[model samples]
Target: MKKNLNFLMGAVLLMATVLFASCNAEDDFLVSPVDSTGAVTRSVTTDPYVIDFANVPAAYTASDKYGANLYTGGAGQITEGYKVQLGNSGTYVQFPVNYLEQEWGEEPRPWQYDYWNGGLAVSDYTDITDGTYLNQCSVYNGGIAGVDNDKFVVAYGYSDFYNDPLSTYDKCAKIYLTDATGYTVVEEGTPVEGTVKTGTFNSVYVCNTTYSQIVMRDGNSFTTGGKSLEEQEGWFKVEFIGFASSDTSVAPTGKVTYYLANFDKSKEEESGLHGEIRTGWNQVDLTDLGTGVHMVVVNFVGSDKSDYGLNTPAYCALDNLSISL
Candidate 1:
């Protein structure tokens, strides 16, 4: 979610300079935006706290420091101001920032949570004043350490800047999760629709399994764990077909529009690039769904696929994700 939209950065600062009114706490406590002045606007450039994957150090060299959080990036080096708590314990917090080094810019992690209520970009999630409702489940994949978090199999997702845990924490913590089966992981051996090996960026150039003489030249060599995928790069995308809920039975009554792109979308459309995520950041707009979301079952689609399976890693860094109260 980490976007480099400097063109609109000034707007956030300019708006913050002015003071606004507060909202009614006793009213719709978990459903609407509570700007004291009654008018609150949020964008990638303007949010109380943006969870851009800045935690992964810019230096992803062949050093042990790069091993930060091999799995879901714990809150080790995330941008200051937010605290991520996994499961119900409220301990061992980690900022989700993976060490992604690529030819272009680098800050991409795939979605990996089990369930989601929705994403938020409120004024102050810390106090929970103007109706801020959130899903209070274990926000990670592979289930929580000791607890039984596998019950929520349908898989829901959320991303934001606040860190207001459901418990009695002062700051507005935010939690995120994705269904490993439907949203991100296709497993090591899954039967994909078409032939995975298309003459695309994924099959020809980036996949770790796909050998190439241009490996080092393309800056795609990760020697730490000797893991082939340590070098996965570029922005990957997934279209939540039908309903945002991962329930294959329910039909998606809405659409998924993007708010970030360097070029005109039309230019990319009508070709393979259409709907496919590019090298830069893209704001995935899910406002149509509102907050009445439980389990999200998407007719998932990806950009990377090998003749064997999904090779284009399904991860990307997140930032400036806004949600209404």
Candidate 2:
């Protein structure tokens, strides 16, 4: 009887150990591993690709050579003006003059003409009340038509700009796209949270001080047949442009910052892309993206560390936003 009782106790302990081991295995499957190399790798069983707004068509005025109003507004107010044009290349679309006013502050902060000591210097506008302006601009061409339908991937690149600070925000631009109905905000640029990418420079009015910073959010997205495309097969691309002023009274400094974020419900956290002080633009490619409705968000940040505090004014331009396939 004694021997039988001992045997039964041993059996019960073994069973408990086995059960505990099984539970641990299950937990391991749910949590991913963090490698020592500072790189994270995960095993995704579902579709990995998604669409992004890179280059959407721009809204042009009746005077534009590329058919007037090729892109019409869908949900928001549409303005008619000469689409912001890139230099001599004619490769990019243009941003509107009121972009900053529409995106950030309510009032228009006009440039202030002032004098310091014995020389003449201008007051750089910083408050959102000052207004929206674009002093610089550029364009990017993401090779889309060449890739196969299966190769649905897009990317956007960002670079730095050098010009007058006071006129940086004079007229910024962004690209948009429309389906059979009209244009929708496919991709655009916005202000970022930090300093501009370029080096430090003197403020227009505060000549004794030098500061550098330009933060704006710029991005693009993709859509199909008038609907937000979030499937694994869709793709998109975009590029950023920086504009500056020519007058010494309006010296602009800073490089473009880049960010890419996805709006899918499943992958919200890992859906963001970013780059800073980049010599060139950064590219984000979403291939084999999931299906359904989707949206892509781009962010641009500027830095202002002048005597005016963190509120020093800045500006940028967007253009050549497009979508295909």
Candidate 3:
């Protein structure tokens, strides 16, 4: 009887050891890094290049007008040396600017009135009130985490320009990578070839503009027939279309869609998404786009539509764009 009892205890110990090993293996797998869409597997090697806008020029911070820099005429001092540098690596992420017409007229035909209506602009506007309709450049959350950073880029996809038959341009903002040549010249002692100019996109932090968030949360005189987005069961989203370096003329390599606000009950039930308006910065993963992603076109769309197209404000704030280069 003593021998039998000892054998039973040894069997139990073996089972416990096997169970512990299995659990440990699963834990490691879950902790392993996976792509945002679960379509690609990647390991975090070098630190990602983060575009936090910490080095913007002092002129951009002037308080004479609004807190945002319009990047007027498509290029200026800000665009001249725009780049992101980390450790020994540096690269350029150029925001597509609408070309300004130079007719040599007085005031050059008020911007966005008779000329460009969409593009990228740098902003630090932070008024989060519902009635502050004039402050279209402000982000509702003020910044990523509302403290860590105050400057970010606002993308405006002009549905009017896109839908206009005579217009030959789409106002959707796009980001393209380039070597740090025409922009920031490498300083002395900095190896030029070490710069990785292009890589697969990892993620980007995004938030709603004060204009968009307010209009969506509370109906305005202009849209939804004075019905709030939630009352109208509306939805809004931003799309990132990734293009490979070799063949951008072809179809996009991949696309990632992130919803800024969703009150559609059908979609919520189908996709298991809780319908809510986004007021804080949310991370949108793009790892599924794979490597050599040279360009990404940002587009905004929504359920609210009129004859001119998307009735919702075509604005969104972007910060902390991560790329594995």
Candidate 4:
């Protein structure tokens, strides 16, 4: 059964230095600090490939050619002005980048300048106050690993897109595996680039965005008939569904569901279970999805429903995503 959900500018010679420094920093982050013998400690089999947005190359985040900026609802946002180049096809990660040209420069496209559509986006916004504004795209605890961590990815899950075959909303963070360089989609029997032999779903850290946390804890003016989760006896969660290589039709190896908020009156009354509005960062293990999983589709579900789908804010912040091959 299918579960329904809704849901850089930079430099040069100093640029080369920045890119080299960024890669080295990412390596350093993945492995421990070097020792007396200049040997870094890391278990190739155990240490998964982690994607920390803070270490994204300067060229991708700052320069004019392949830059991406967070949607700040101001002059800083870049809807269609920027482009992203996937370095290689072996194994690459991508967040949705809906170009304005395709949709008449719409304001709510996946990569729009104002409101976020259902998709994945890179963000470092840290405002935790004013949950009323849909544009406040920050984790409640600020970061998954720590409060001061530089960057994380925000995901908006729309069930209508995932459930509707004709829907065009891009609603998931994708890791593509290609047979060779320059390819964007996964190919069966094609080797993934790097040392990874087979793609494995490890884990990811998830937390409620400020907009979601507040709306779940307290009623918001919009949606759910202006009722909180407590009042509506509702729940909110995201599902990570893993698919086989080159195949994405409903069938998946497995699915992992992580709840962002749950307010069941029965459970609270009978088992002494207090309502849970997720705070800080919680790790959702995906090992159950198993190895050889090339793609994972994430979507959100909530008890508050209208004809349009989930009424609760469908936003979640993710960080420290670990994948192994």
Candidate 5:
């Protein structure tokens, strides 16, 4: 009887140990949607090259104008550098070096006639629903098509906050985009009669249920770059592009240019994005000018421009900056 009692107690202890182990494993594997700082967090990589973008509290909306020296670099004197912003659209958007404060839910507070005049537009100017509508606007935080990065900064070509190339948020990092992973797009395969297509992204296939194009699961839509299936037939459409130059002499001067993106394109269009950003970590090479590059500025411009204003939002995303100091 004594032996049997001891056996029973041992069995109970083993079961308890298993349960405790399982619970600990689950806790370690959990991925939080919003980071502890409440700011959106992207690729949780231990890569050494990644920038030192620290998270601020959600209420921190402080922003600075451009043209000031950016990097303090632990030295009392300001180090000559620019803060690199990665457009969720895959373009490089630059802010004043002082604009380094990466905050969460930072709304577009315009400083000009049409910077972020969301209420001025017939509809919400910030509305990028149709891919075409958000011209000259600003794209803030986003969750994209695949698990590229949990969160990132987005800036369109014309997204210089004060619209001044001479000054204001004008510097961008030069990066080489080389992979498209987990990129999810939807085709309006056999569109139901009432389905309404929205954004006119190049990757989107507009047709009825009987048409042939990109394949998407029925009754459910795919999500990418911070949006779900774009149209009713194709509710959410997203297009990401990027541009760079070997010339780092100034902002927007590109005698030599480079194209980068994840997806494939038949021909080179005049738009900024070379291709869409893919899922997983991609290999980006930023050596257009070779090593010893002190710094590079992003000159984000777009085709949708006129005297009155520019088109497309000002936003971009960047991470894992590979450079030699």
Candidate 6:
């Protein structure tokens, strides 16, 4: 009997030891440094490059009379030539700009216009539903007119703020320009890129002379060298590229949240203009962007909880906004 008991005790001890070893192996796997194989993933460790507001060019700092106020209610007017509508229930109005004719004389080129009823018209402008419409206005006589006239009408759709006013995120979109030289501009059809998971959406616009405009997910937008008397001459659209995420576990879902920086009201008031302008990183998702030969724009949309206004108006700044693989 004593011999049998000893054997049983020994077996139990051996089983316990095996179980403990298995647990230790799992712990080591969790903490081990990942191999640098192409298959093995790594996080973006390099700190994002921040823009030096002091380095802003004189052209970027110039005042823009055409700069539109975003907070105005109902079919807000953008400069003397453009009008914007707010809300979900409304008729689609055509936009007529003389600049189109001045740029492409006698030739009727395809022009894309963004409609923001509920939120800013970003890349999702193509996803216009019954409640929202981002219609392309036909060009005539090389130029579309109707700034002081009623030829163009502004429309609106459902207001995200009405449903949830306390929400931190705001739905917005922007257009940018890009040319053969790989210079991106803030123009029509600029691709919007970013991740809108849970609540936060941030993105950076790489501001370069090669690039023209930095359209925000919010209704407000900016140009690099300020506004020129010749409009369409310097404006074009950027193609869609991809984005990178700081956290790999939370894979981006081709959506983004809204963040406003650089322009502070108190600071703007302190200065002669609206506010001091600063530049920082704008976070985004790059899942949609494929490899090589593409431009990108970032947009943010969601329930309205944040204010879209700058006490100081300034050009948009961007850095390290690129796609790899």
Compared with the true structure, what per-residue lDDT tens digits does model 4 show for residues 25-100?
A: 4332331211312232243333355666775543333222112343444435533221122122234444443321
Off by over 4 Å in 3: 1-46, 60-81, 100-116, 130-133, 142-147, 158-169, 181-197, 245-248, 269-272
- Return the TM-score for each candidate structure: 0.29, 0.23, 0.67, 0.66, 0.31, 0.22
Q: CA lDDT of each candidate? A: 0.24, 0.23, 0.61, 0.56, 0.26, 0.24
Best by lDDT: 3
Candidate 2 runs further than 4 Å off: 1-134, 138-178, 183-276, 287-290, 302-325
lDDT of 3 at 65: 20
User: How well is each residue in 1-325 modelled by candidate 5, as lDDT tens digits?
Assistant: 9999999999999999999897544322222222233333323322222332233111111121110112223222121112322212222212222222222345642121111211100001122232322122212113121123222222223323344444322233222221111111122221111111111111111111100011111211222222221121221112222223323234431122322221223323532333432122233333333332322333443322345333323233333333222
TM-score of 1: 0.29
TM-score of 6: 0.22
What value does the lDDT take at residue 298 in candidate 3?
A: 80
Clashing pairs in 3: none
Q: Which candidate achieves the best TM-score against the true structure?
A: 3
Cα deviation of 95, candidate 3, in Å: 3.1
Error of 6 at 130 (Å): 36
lDDT for model 4, please: 0.56
TM-score of model number 3: 0.67
lDDT pick, better of 4 and 6: 4
Model 1 lDDT vs. the true structure?
A: 0.24
- Single out the weakest 10-residue window by summed lDDT for candidate 3: 26-35
